[model samples]
Each structure stands twice: as structure tokens, then as C-alpha cells.
Target: MVQDVTLVDGAGSGPAAARIPPAPLGRNRDFLLLWSGASMSFLANRVTTVAYPLIVLWHTGSPLAMSVVSTAALLPLLLVQLPAGALVDRWDRRRLMLVCELGRVAAVGSVALALAAGRVTVAHLAAVAFTEASLAVFYRLAERGAVRNIVHPAHLSTALSRNEARGRAAGLLGQPGGVLLQSAGRWVPFGFGVLGYLVSAVSLLLIRKDFQQERDPTAGRGRMAGEIAEGMRWLWRQRFLRAAFAYVAGTNVLFQMLALALILRVKEAGLPSATLAIVLGIGGVGGLCGALVGGWVQRRARQRTLLIAGAVAWAVLIGAMGFTREPVLLGALYAGTGFVGAVFNVAAAVYQVRTTPDALQGRVAAAAGLVGSGTNALGSFAGGLLLAAWGALPTVRAIAIAMAVLALLAAVAPDLKGELPDDGTDTDAVG
Candidate 1:
């Protein structure tokens, strides 16, 4: 028989806020280790992500092969997230992360070896991509949970902000790093991934703290489906979270479409590809800047205010992009949107982490991610169709209008009016 569980009441929990504060994040040794290792791994993943298609195209000269490998890499985000979340909650998270990193070393290393031996095949590439991505999913989920345990609750927002910035920085550098490395040799990026994963594994080994709170062994081990459901049910009960995630989903879709539209706009205007790259690079810098300030913003702004304001800001910026074609102007406008997005992500992550019980952290994070980003592919496909039918200008204007609608809804939504309570504590129980 399944045992009964009482999930932490996020809204009502207050004791978490009273916990003793830890050292500043800069001086926190474990956080630094976690950050450095994750930063390297994230950068390496970005490098390989860029290289995968380049290598596929260079070798096979087939768009289909490139698409197959790309799809394999993305498939894990859609497939592995939920089960991985469940397992992360059930397993030793640090060990799981170590295993993931080591697994990635082998998976990515195989590709490098194959490429060097001139034995690389589409099937082999697809398999390796899928394996590496799957491991990454697990590692990311575990790391999400692990971060809360290693830091004090008071610094959660600051810690997450730095992490967000690290990710943006990795993306900013990794694309160019991948292209540069690929120019030297197709196998070089994969070799980098192997090295990065090894460093990440070492970092995991050095972390001495437990990744999760003690579990009740007597609470009968539940089925994976039940565990996932428990997390979903908890999440669904929080009106603020539900509204926040819905807003996030809408904005995420709009951003995905906007990115594609930007590329098409550049091409249609007969601008050099370098112009587009520069605009995107500027936007990446904007995101990094926003992440750097996220903790300060979160400390001052109410959650409801931030969400509504960010949406409105996005509406204005995206609308402006629809009317402009000048490269500098376009880059500045896109940068504004990126800035808002990074800040919004940091705030949302802080809220989620501070309120979730340690045991449910992985599952909750996975559910939120799935809800927030599940429609990205659909958005990309719809953007392509819209651009094909109505051109870039019209499609972008339509998205701006949609964003405006989202903003208006957020402003009036009863559930989003007040601040969400955060006790800054982990509320875990077995069912």
C-alpha cells in the first residue's frame, strides 16, 4: 500500500525564513566549485550543440542528417525531463550528477574518437547526441536541487542570479567557441565536451554536503508516476505558480518566434549575416547584464509587479522591433527584451527554489520547465508558417499584440496581484 504524504505548504511555511545565514556566496567554497564545474559543462555543451550540425553538414552535406541529429538532441528535453526529475528526487543527487558527467564523457568521447578514426556516421552521431543530452537533463535537474542544500535560504536569489548569468555567458561564448573549434577540426568540440564533463565530475566529487534532506525510508517506495503526480499536484495547487508559469509559457513562445523572425528579417533586408550575429551578440550581453542585476531587482520588486512590467516591456520592445530594420537599432531593441527575460527568469527561479521542499525540488523544477518551455517547438513551427504567409513585419507585429494581451491579463489577474509568500525553507515529506 502507498503511504500518505503531506507536501510542504509553500504559502504557509514560515520557519524557513528564520534559519541561520551562511557566508557570502563569493566565499562559499562549495558554491564556487558547483558554479565553476557547471559553468564549464554548460559552456562545453553549448560548444558541442553548435558543432553537431556543422559537423553533420560538413560530412554528409545533408540537411536531413543535420535535422536528425538536432532532433535527437532536443528530444531528451521533451522525453527525459519528467522521469529524470522523479529519479533525481529518489536517488543521491550528487552521485547522480557525477554519474551524468562521467556518462557524458564517454558519450561525447566516442564521437571524438570516431571522428578522428574517420568512422563517424549519422547513426553514431545521433546516438551520442541523444545520450549526452539525456545525461545533461539529469545533471541539470540534480544540480537545481543540489544548489538549495549547499547555500543558505537568504542567498538563494543571489546564487540563482549568478547561475543565470553563468548560463547566458556560456551561451554568448560557446557559439563562437564551437565555430572556431570546428574550423580547426570537427572532433575538437567533442574533445572539449569530454574534458569539461571530467572537470564537472571532479567538482561533484568534492562537494561534501548532501543534495537532499533525509528521506523517510519507511515511507514505502512509490511508483515513478505517483512521484511525478505528487509534484504536479503540489504545483497546480499554487495559484501564483500556475499563473506565473502560464505567463512564462506565453512569453517563451513569443521569444522563440521572435528569434526566428529576426533572422528572416535580416535576410529579407539583404543585410550581411554578420549584422545578424552582432545583433544577437548584443542581445546576449543584455541578458548577462540583466542576470547580474537580478538579485537586486528581486529584492526590491514585488513578484507581481515584475511579471506584469516585464511583459509590458517586452510588448513595447517587440513592437519596436517590428517597425525597425537598422542593425544597430534592432540590436538595441532586442537587447532590451533579453534583459527583461533574464531578470524574469531569475525572479521566477528564486521563488520556485525557496518555496519547494528539497525532496520535490527536482520534480517541481522539471514540471515548471516542461510547462514553461513545452511549446517552444510549436512556436518555432508556427513562426515559420506565419513568416511564410505574412512576412516578418506582420508576423512580429502580431506577436507584439499577443504579448500585450498577456500583459493586460497579468495586470488584472486576481491571483497575480499580491506577493507570493516565501518562507525560504524546504518542505519535504514522503507519501
Candidate 2:
């Protein structure tokens, strides 16, 4: 009788095939749960985004004050990036997810209470949003590595593609959902926020230890600073990853400019906030379509081809949006941009996870994210000044042109053209 065999494959420990299963199909149950948890969390996040802004604007009626809350939210990326990623490398990711969600529950729960008690101030709102977003970085860094643990090497691309889609969904639905809830009643959104965190926590419970157990080592000791530094250094060596990070960071700047221009244009035209929300909300449909098609694109399109196409599409769609004030027309343009962004984002996440060592996923994600936060901030500030100087439509056109040029340049990265360094690299199957 033929006997069943199993193997521990890492660092040249087994036949590469045994260690690296086929890019995971739907075979990994635990991975599905993890994706679900993160996806729901993303949707909840979008749903709640408007609660704080609406509350602040409603209470204080000052755009500048609300803007401060937005800016303060970026501080945590600077503060926690290094330690967070290092710790994520060490921590039991499942436990970390549970803990982070609970911490958020407590923080937002307190904010909800304070709001109810009439003690919520601009300062209070800023602190809560910053804390929530900060903890998210920690939970996400921990989860990124944990993904490889649950899924086989074969499934990584599809898994990441699905993950990226959730992000687009969050933007598509989350922002508008938040706006909708705030319209119903401010406190209603907070109640919904609390529930979303609870849902995330509950999903974590369903992901069994056997399914979610990480494949990476949690051993290694150093001063916290050194540990963090080590993670960063490892990521820098990967040629493909470095280019992806730069590409993402640059495009984010363009996104901020577009967003700021949209705001100014609406204000100048005396359009209702509802109109902006609805059009942008519908624009999210493009992201959904992009995400749905991402897996097919990954399988058929060369990496470089997908990236170049996505970048070009992003520039064109955003440019089209610049010329439209009609609600339906702008919605279509925004949706198309969302679609292109989904394709670009999903493809990039898959490439990074495939290229980077499992040990470095958290730090790599953190560094890339840090770049995004800082660049987006600078762009937002620039957007405000541009609006004051040349008006909203000009700013939009400028961003569109920049996107086109950046995409053209970034399209030339060697890996995107199929010189992928990790195309056949067999990595540990992380949970």
C-alpha cells in the first residue's frame, strides 16, 4: 500500500514542491476566514469614516478644525511603524488581532460614550481617530504575515488580489456608508462602528489555531530598535518591492490632489455635500469591477502589462472626472478610477508578498504604508494651496497629468516587464 507522506520544508528542508503547494486554490479554509475578517473590518471602516467628519463639522462648523483631525490621524504611522512591524513578526498574530480589535472597541466605545455625554470635543475626536488608525497598522502588520501561514504558495496571488479588492470595497462603500449613517443621526454611526469591531472580533474566534498558525519563526531577540531596523533592511534588498512602494507612494499623492480638487470644485459650485458623496460613492463601483476581474488579469496579463494598463487607466479616468460636474457623469468617472486603482493595488500586493521573505512582510507593508501616509499628507496640503491659487479644476488637471507621466515612467520597472525575481521562488506556506 502506498503510504501518506508529509514534510517540513524550509531553508532547503524538503522537495520544493512539498513545501510550496500550488498557488492556493480555495483549499485553505483558514485563509478564507482571515480574508473575511479583514474584509468586514474594511467595510466597517468605510462605513464609519463619515461619522467623525460629520460630527466635527456639525458641531464646530469649521473646515479647518475637521482638517486637523484628518492630519493628526497620520501621526501614528510615524510613531509606531518600526516597533509595530517588529512586534508583529514576533507576536501570535491571532492573539494580536483579537487584542487590537478589543483595544479599538474600548477606544471607540469611550468616544461613543463621550459623544453621548456631550464631552466629545475636536481634540477628543482627533485622539480617538488617530488611536484607532494606529492600532489598525499593528493588527494589519501582524495579519499580513499570518496570511502566508494559512494559504499555500499557489494561492498567494489570488489571496492578495481578494484582499486588495476589499480595500477598494471599503473606499467604495465605507465612505458613503459613513456619510449615510451620519445623515440618519450622528450617534447611530458610532453604534454601528462598535458593532463592526465586534464583528471583526467574532470572526477571529472562528479561525481555528490549526488553520491560522503562522509558518514563520517568532524567535530572535534584540533591542526593539534594532529588531525594527532589521526588518526594514531586509525589505530594501528586494528590487521589485522597492519599486512597488515608490509607485504606490507616488500615485497616492495624485489621489490626494484629486480628492482635494473635488472638494473645492463642489464648494465653489455651491453643490450639496450629498451630491459629492453620491457621485463619489457610485465611483466606487469601478473598484468593485476591477477587483472582480483582478484574478483573471493576474493569470493572463504579464505583471508589467497589468501595472502599466492600471496606471494609464487611473490617469485617464481621473482626468475625465475633472471635466464633469454632472452627478451621473462624475460618478461614472470616479467609478472607473476606483476600478483602475483596484487592479493596480491588488496586483502590487500580490507581487510584494510573492517577492519578499515571509519574515519581512510586516515591515515591508509598514514601510510602504508609512510612505503613503506622509506623501498623502504633503499632497493634501499642496492641494489646499493649489485650490487657493488656481481653483479646483486646474488642480485636478495637474494631478491627472502627473499621474500619466508617473505611470509612464513607473511602467518601465524591470519586474513589471516579466523579469520577476521571485517568479519561481518557493516560499513557506504561511497561515
Candidate 3:
């Protein structure tokens, strides 16, 4: 007789898989609910991403004011990540997510209502955006930590890849949807976003299973500062993970610079905004395709092979951008870069999920986000400075060369290779 056994939870302890009856992920009702809810949240967030700036620009008619609003929204990432991650690990992830959605509903809905009443101001928009974005930091970290509890271990990679695709699809549609809604009415986009968050909250409420494993009573009892430091220390101790973080950080900077340079190049060539849209659309398609095929790629290739291949592809694609100004060639190169980036993202995400314990997922994610935030800001600064000083082609080539060097370094990290670790031990925490 087949014994009914519970799969090991992401916190690392439960029943052994050898004696358990496996459920196909497709039929896993709880996983489906969580997935659908997350997709809605992502879609709504993307919609607001566009609508926020549009509304600001409409109300103030000043690009400087718009930039200030954007900075206000993003500044929280640097400040909130460390503590947010710690709190997520301490709280009930499902409830945390639900509360976040409700908060978003209030924030976005307030904007809509204010616009309808002709009382919306730039200050109001900035305050709402900052508040909502702050809450989002917690919500996302909580959701990532919670994913492992809802699906089988074998399906985690597939689930994550699907999540990536959902984000890509959201990106592809959300901006256009916001623009169209804005054309109808300024409040329409925010209203649409509010509805999405409400639906998302309903989905969270419908989930029957717990979103976190039972925590050890002593695990999270330390001081908040100590807990945050512990998470960072744990992450740094993993050789491959440290390397992966560096690789991602470097590429993020490179891509940010390259993206800015592309726009400069296009404008210098007198290309229209429509052309820019087409190029971005092509990149989106590439990202979506890569995300969809990520599971297949994971199944077929070793982690080392995937990372190395993706790195090489990025090097080639970015390097090629410097050699041509043809919009079609530039677009194709950009798309290729996006495809490789997606592959790397899936592989890195699987690595992170498999190796880290559920308890520390939030802190680790937050620490990583904190690092990326700094690097991305530096990248934006450097991109504009470099393009202005050296012109587009030369700056593009310099950035590509720097990126290729990083990729080469990543290709040789021994800890990043072979099969996923099977010992089921979080190197930092035995539980």
C-alpha cells in the first residue's frame, strides 16, 4: 500500500518524499490559487507603473516633478529591503500578502477617487506611490518565501519559470493597457488596478493550505539587526550563490547603461518613438519566449552549462550593438540579450530556491534586492555620463566589454556547476 505522506516543506523538515504519494502540480489546487493571485498582483502593479507617471506628468506638466515622483517611489527600495525581509520571515506570509493587497487597493483607489473629484495633486500622487511601493517590497518578499510551501520540490523550477512568464506577459500588456485607459479617463487605469488588487486579495483568502512551514519557536527570536545580519552572512557563505549575485549585479549595471545608450543612439539617428516601441516589443517577445522555455532548458542542461551559455550569449549580443545603428539590427540584438537574460534569471532563481531554507528566503531576497538597487542606481548615473562624454557607440562598446569580462569570470565558478544539492540541508541552518 502506498503510504500517504506529506512532502518536505521549504523550511526543510516534514515527511520524507520516498514514502509519499506525489501529486501532479497541474492538479494542485492550492498552487493554482497562489499562482493566479500572484499574476493578478503583478499585472496590476505594472499598470500602476505606467499610470503613475502619466498622471504626474498630466497634473504638473513638469518633467522634473515627474522625476521627483519616480525617485520617491524607488527610494524605498534602498531603505526598506533589509527590514522588510526580516519582518516577512517573522510574519504569516499569506496574511501579510493579503494585507498588502488591501493596502494597495486603498492607495490606488484613493488616487482614482481623487482624480474623479478633481482633487488629485502631485503631492498626493507621490505620497500614494511611495506608500504603495513600500508595501510592495514586503508583499513580494513574502510571496517568494511562500511559493515553496505550495508546490512539490520537483515542480519548483517549472513554477518559477511560469512566474517569470507571468511577469513578462504583464510587462507586455500593462503599459499599453494603462495608456489606453488614460485616454478614456485618468482615473480609469487606477480604477482598473484597484479591481485587480481586490481580485488578488480574494484569491489569497480562498487558499486552504498554510503558506509557511511551522517555524521553530527559537528561530526568529533574535534582535532585528542581528537577524538581518545573519541573513546576509548566510548568503555570503555560499560560494556559488555569492558568485551568482555578483554576476547578476554586474549585468544589471551593464544593461541599464546599454539601455540608456540605445535611446540616445535612436534619438541621434532621428528615429521616432514608434520605432522605440517596436524595439521594446521585440525584446518583450524574446523575454516571454525564454521564460516559457525555461523549464525545458533546466531539464536538459546542467546549471553550469546554462549559465555559461547565457553569459556568452549576452556578451555577443551586447557587443554587437556597438557595431550597428540599423534599428532592425539593434532591435534584434536587444531581443537576443533579453532572451539570454531570461534564461539566466530562471537558472539563478532555481539555484536560490533549492539551496536556501524557507525561513531565510525573505531576508536573503531583501539583501539581494538592496545590493541590486545600489548597483542599478550607479548604472543609471554612469550610462548617462558615459553616453554624454564618449558618444553612443563608444560607450556602448565599453559597457559591452565590461559585461563580457564579468561573464567570463562567472563561467569558471566551480560551486555553480553540476546538479542541485540533494543533501536538503541549508548550509547555514540545519533545520
TM-score winner among the candidates? Answer: 1
Sorting all predicted structures by TM-score, with the top scorer first, yields: 1, 3, 2
Tens digits of per-residue lDDT, candidate 3, 213-267, equal 7788777878999999988988876666776777778888888898898888888
Question: Per-residue CA lDDT of candidate 1, range 77-169, in tens?
Answer: 899899888888888888899899999999999999999999999999999999989998998888988877777666778988999999999
| TM-scores vs. true structure, each candidate | 0.94, 0.84, 0.93
**TM-score for predicted model 1 compared with the true structure:** 0.94
lDDT of 2 by residue, 1-431 (tens): 11111222222223474455453356556676788878777766666556777888888999999888876666787878767887776666788888888888887788778877877899988988888888888987877766655665556567777777778777766776787877786676777778878888888898763323335453546687787776666555545556667777888888888887887777877889888877777777777888877766776766667666777887888788777788788888888887777777777666666665555667767777787777977788888888889998888888888888987887666643433533443121211
The deviation in Å at residue 302 for candidate 2 is: 2.6
- Where in model 3 is the C-alpha error above 4 Å? 1-15, 18-21, 413-431
lDDT score, candidate 1, position 248: 88
Clashing pairs in 1: 3-431, 357-427
| CA lDDT, every model vs. true structure | 0.85, 0.72, 0.81
The lowest-lDDT stretch of 10 consecutive residues in candidate 3 is: 1-10
Q: Which stretches of candidate 1 lie over 4 Å from their true place?
A: 1-21, 424-431
Could you tell me how far off, in angstroms, the CA of residue 182 lies in candidate 2 after the best superposition?
4.0
